[model samples]
Target: MQRVRVLVIDDSALVRKLLSTMLACDPAIEVVGVAADPLIAREKIKQLEPDVLTLDVEMPRMDGLTFLENLMRLRPMPVVMVSSLTQQGAEVTLRALELGAVDFFTKPSNDLASTFAAGAQEICAKVKLAALTRPRVRTIVRKLEVAPRLSADAVLPRAQTPDSRGGSRIIAIGASTGGTEAIRVVLEAMPPDAPPILITQHIPAAFSGPFAARMDNCSAMRVCEARDGQPIQHGHAYIAPGSQHLLAMWDGARYVCRLHDGPPVNRHKPSVDVLFRSVAATVGAPAIGALLTGMGDDGARGLAEMREGGAMTLVQDEASSVVWGMPGAAWKLGAASEMLPLDHIAARLLELARQPIARAMRAVT
Candidate 1:
């Protein structure tokens, strides 16, 4: 098996060393070269021909974003961002995703070496995942072995019967890795008075609020990080807080958001499985579930449950996904009623939103 060759670019010597060390810890990743700035990295990229790149947000000579824009326009390949955990960092990282980065991870504010060491597994995994993305150097498909993890049951129990309590239709969406940009594309295309959207995208606690704010700027609908016990309203999109699990619950008379402080389901705090299962139980046939571009199979099982409960389900097609793991898993499990490209999902969802739940259920059945 050919290992994933990587180029590490950072202004900080310590960071460059730390990143290289962490990546080397994985047998599947080979640190081919390191660069102190984008200029040096540019030449190294041509020389080493690395399969993936770990780029720093702040750099000398040229900023990471500028270099990324140039690289993507000229020679596109998978790039993973290494950023700080500050508010500014979160904003910049989101921009990097929009600029076509496959994924990102924040460096520790203090105790850099120890912290980087502790996150070695995650760093290596992200690099390997990036290697599998578009403009690939080679085709490398390997199933990563993950430790046993808790399911949606750890947060919310599966309903014996679909709740069927809500009067209006609801939309549930989940994604990770390449999801931020994909979600932005879908939400930006939605009409102002579209059905309420509930989203779970795997992200750090510091980034979710900024991500929501960014989405709100471009999307016609009001998009915001969800608040506990908030009323679910039409023309609004609610994103799960990075630190808590956001669940859609029918509060006797109306649907509301309930935030849970449960253990990480599927190794994620704001897990897609938890949100999807909650929607399946509380909204039932009136809900529409879509699983977008992401790494891992976090939402696949929950989407299947949504289908069984009579909800219309959709998965993003592989050709349009940055990483097809989540949506592909759903496709393989026969969870999605239809698999569509990223550009067409919003229109299709709006079409379904206009139909009566009973008729939509009949169509899917």
Candidate 2:
């Protein structure tokens, strides 16, 4: 098998060296070259024709976003952004993803050497996954080896029985990898009066707030990071905070968001499984669950739980996903009641939301 060739582009020599060394440590990857800025990168890209790129968020001659925009417009290829763990970095990295970058990772604020070493596995895994994805296109369906990880049960116990309380229907969504953009697509199309949406997207603590803010700007529904004990209401979308697990709980009369500071489940702090299981237990048949694009199987079991609890479950079709790991796993497990393209998910959710609770419950039965 051919090794993935990667070009390291960063303004800092230390970053370039560290990124190249970490990536090279993986036998499946080869560091083709390094560039100090986008200008140098442009030349090297034409010369080396590497399979993937690790670009720094801020560069000297040209910024990463600008370079990414130009590259996608002309010659598109898989690019993973390397950014700082800061507010500014989060905003820039999100822009990079919008410009067709495959994924991103935050650089440590301090202890560069040790931090980089510690994240070597994650860094390599992202690059390798990016290589399998088409630039500015949907992700190729594939699976990667996940490290030993805890299940949603580690954070919250499985509900003994599905909760069938009388309340407004809610929507639950989970995504990773290429999810940020894919999520933007869904939110933009939703109506202002859409059902309450609970989302769990794999992100860093610094990025989730900015991500929610960005989505709020584009979505008619009010979008915000989920708060502990916050009431879930119509026309609002609650995003799971990057540092905590967000769950739905029946608060006597209405559903409310509950944030848990528990161990990471399925290697994610805001595990989709944790959120889905909670919805299955609390919202039951009236709840609608959709598993979007992601790299791993975190949400598969949770979505199945939702289906078993008589909730309508959907999975994004592989053709529209950047990585089909999560949704594909759900479909294979027979968790999804329907598989739809990215464009159709919002409409289906709204249509399902309009159904009488009894009818919606009957469809799953």
lDDT of 1 by residue, 1-365 (tens): 99999999999999999999999989999999999999999999999999999999889899999999898889999999999999999999998998888889788899998999999998899999899988422111222223344568889998775454655799999999789988988888887778899999999899999999999998879999999999999889999999999999978767999999999998999999999999999888889999999888999999998988888899999988988999999999999999998888888888888787777556445
Residue 1 lDDT in candidate 1: 93
**lDDT agreement of model 1 with the native:** 0.90
lDDT per residue (tens digit) for residues 296-347 in model 2? 8989999999989888889999988888999999999999989998878888
- Sequence-dependent TM-score of model 2: 0.90
Per-residue lDDT of 145 in model 2? 24
- Return the lDDT, model 2, position 311: 88
Model 2 collision count: 1
Residue range with the least summed lDDT across 10 consecutive positions in model 1: 136-145
